[model samples]
Target: MCNQTTTAEKSSPTHIYFDSPEKHCRGTDYLCCSISDIISEAKSLFNLAFPIALTGLILYSRSIVSMLFLGYLGDIELAAGSLAIAFANITGYSVLSGLALGMDPLCSQAFGAQRHKLLSLTLHRYVVFLLFTSIFISFLWINMFNIMVYLQQDHNITRIGQRYLLFSLLDLFTNSFVHPIRIYLRAQGITRPVALASFFGTFLHLPISFVLVSHFNFGVSGVAASASISNFFVLISLVAYIWVSGIHEPTWEKPSFECLTGWKSLLKLAVPSCVLVCLEWWWYEIMIVMCGLLVNPKALVASMGILIQTTSLLYVFPSSLGFAVSTRVGNELGANRPYKARLSVAVAMFISAIMGLSALTFATALRDKWALMFTSDTQILRLTSVALPILGLCELGNCPQTVGCGVLRGSARPSTAANVNLGAFYLVGMPVAVGSVFYIGIGFSGLWLGLLSAQVCCAGLMLYVVESTDWEQQAKRARMLTCIDIRQPDDFDCNKGEVEQPLTCSA
Candidate 1:
């Protein structure tokens, strides 16, 4: 039997071996992980997570700045701006961000396996896709006034909101490039530059917004323009950095006709990614829309907007953790190191829990003060205060579940994440929110309670999927995905370490 095993190993070209027992521990399954190994993994995850979190926080601050200016303009402007922004997110940014995310696994895995041309091609294709998507979104923005009026929104609010959306048109195009480029860079484990560029743009946003909205009194249009300008600045900064540093040269592939075609596989992943993101993002916007149905909608809508900003702020931690883990897991799987990928997920979940707890504490402790940063309206402030703790509670489930979503994406299982989100948000959470608020008459807090329910359910489901994952199978899938030119069944034998012959792409 021993002689047979040796002969089998010698015949398998793909068989992995380690130089020592310690190397074996690093390369094999997670069952052999020691306390020290866990600690080491934790540190690595954090190192990647911190800069991403910082970048999210900084980039998000641009909108907060926009909201602050709107708040200063008075409650009417604040509500209008909030509504417009929510619409834009549901119809525009969310779609772009989600579609761009489809590249996460492809880029990360391609980079891990040193398939540099594949990484570059994927990025090029996404840029083209997002640009085309922006055109449709632009048309949507142009019809914002008609849509809002058709929906029976207040004429005054709709008028201002329409202007806001119209002025935001430029941002749509800039983001097409920004979102894809960020993902491309992030796949290479390059984050600090992105963060630095975000900081610079956000810093410039303050003055530009002040000049346009405050000093010149351009109102909603000025605020929108400032945001667009800031986004453009970020895009320029990132491009210049790439050119100056030439860090992308190694992985950068010349644009080819191939990028224009062969989108079937990309769309398979991109569509699901877009769906999951839209499902989650649209829920928040749906909540804002629901607010309009409640009594005194102006105050409620404004309050909901403020609360959403607060959530976005808290989201930085989990978002970063999710991003880091996705990249880490993709890289590991692409390298055929299933154990390392599993470790990344485990470490990310632990860190997400800690961050969630911290967010909950922060929200509860400063429930009163947090809203002051956004608005001065007494009713809006009171309503925001009442819901802050609930939002905090939601984060408890939000953090871990978010990390879980990243894990699934890294493993190229976006469809599972999409299905989980559909059930959690629409099937479970939506009914509760509608029932509690409209049917049970629980008021504003009921909406948050529904979100909390969704988050909890999502977290549980995500963790179950994560725990049940077959890491070796995922490693096999990664190999096939990174091969780029191959279009064949992954007949790699995990037990025997035998790989199947690759076939050429059809057409």
Candidate 2:
């Protein structure tokens, strides 16, 4: 007989974290029910979040290192390199990273369900899909010079930007491979290896950029080349660790033709995931590009770059928590533990709120001083100070919204998050931003305020969606989706029976 277990059966937990509530609580007090429960959730979140945040910080420092090297070259080189990096992020890097996120739901759910072979196949498929996607993105980079020219950017800056992008093209292929490997490991809660690899890679980057640009006189191209080379180093190190460590041995399967079979489901999630990320990432890039068309374009563009970098630096905390919660929530749901999944979301939001407040205080307090790290120009510094407070305020909403989106992804609801982003950023934020910058004449400060508005809107929408979510249904969906072959009777039946052995909760 086919194995059968209903949602009602899975909803009843053998072990309860809270004393009073047998049923899942939608109230805020749910998280505060027991001190021990809160402590356990915090420990689990911190363990996962710390390494991811550190890895993000280490990786982000590579760009900062490159920018510092270029700054020594000249203001023009600094401005041009920044522009090229922003453009690359919008056109290439962000898209690739977002698309690769398709693996999050699949791999995390598969690992949670103990479907080891399914995890291996999904990883292989993403590798293949991302590599093909990189080729098209590479074509865009090759033609970026012309695209910049058509946009009527400065001739000298355009030339320098093109040179930087030419060398940076190598990262396209390297990252295509590296990102999936990183995500595959992350799905299994193995974040320290990637963090270690990023630390070593970034530690090498400073000297590499110094030698290539200053010692060899390769100019801006050297900065770009060093960044790409550092990524390759990280990739090599991660691959070596994965093989030698044997930690992921059970999930490692020989490459097979069956890996090609999941394009439809993967793309269904990937396209929306891409849209979800790109909508948010590309907004900042668009603001940077728009700044280039303003009066005092160079100074404004440079100031915007500093602001973007600073915000990105602070963003590591919330983004890390988002990734952590996604894994935690998805794992619980896959294991058919709806109560635990809801608890993870509550804990993640609480953590993000505290982090957001801390970020706001830091950004506001250092508004005057933060820009000094990047540039000394009085105008650029003044503009950045004006924007920093707004950027900090924006984080209050942005951080929680980020975690909220992660909850949606874990629940197999990327499309819902995508729709919220579309309406919030485009329908509401973009118009306000354009009017503020051009018609209202408030400049970069106005641009940030618009973003803050969008964040507020997104946060409200996501909170509602997550609050209203049917955890039992989400758990059912996760089980169905993670099955090796949901269409097959034996595999489908096997998955239903698999959930009978309740998943053990661990940090």
RMSD of each: 5.6, 5.4
Candidate 1 runs further than 4 Å off: 1-30, 484-507
TM-scores vs. true structure, each candidate: 0.91, 0.91
Compared to the true structure, candidate 1 yields what TM-score? 0.91
* Local accuracy of candidate 2 as per-residue lDDT tens digits, 1-507: 111234323243322223354333433213223567767877888999999999999988887877677777877888888889888999888988999887788778878888787778877888899899989998888888799888877778878999999999989999899888888888899999999888888888988888898899999999999999999999888888878999778788888887677477678878999999999999998887888888877888888888889888988999999999999988887777776787788889888889889989999999999888777789988999888899999999989999998888877788899999999999999999999988999987889989999989988898888877777678777766764334446434542444442111111
Off by over 4 Å in 2: 1-33, 484-507
**Candidate 2: 10-residue stretch with minimal lDDT:** 498-507
Error of 1 at 358 (Å): 0.8
RMSD of 1: 5.6
- Model 1: how far is 72 from its true place, Å? 0.6
Give the whole-model CA lDDT for all candidates, comma-separated.
Answer: 0.85, 0.82
Q: Pairs clashing in candidate 2?
A: none
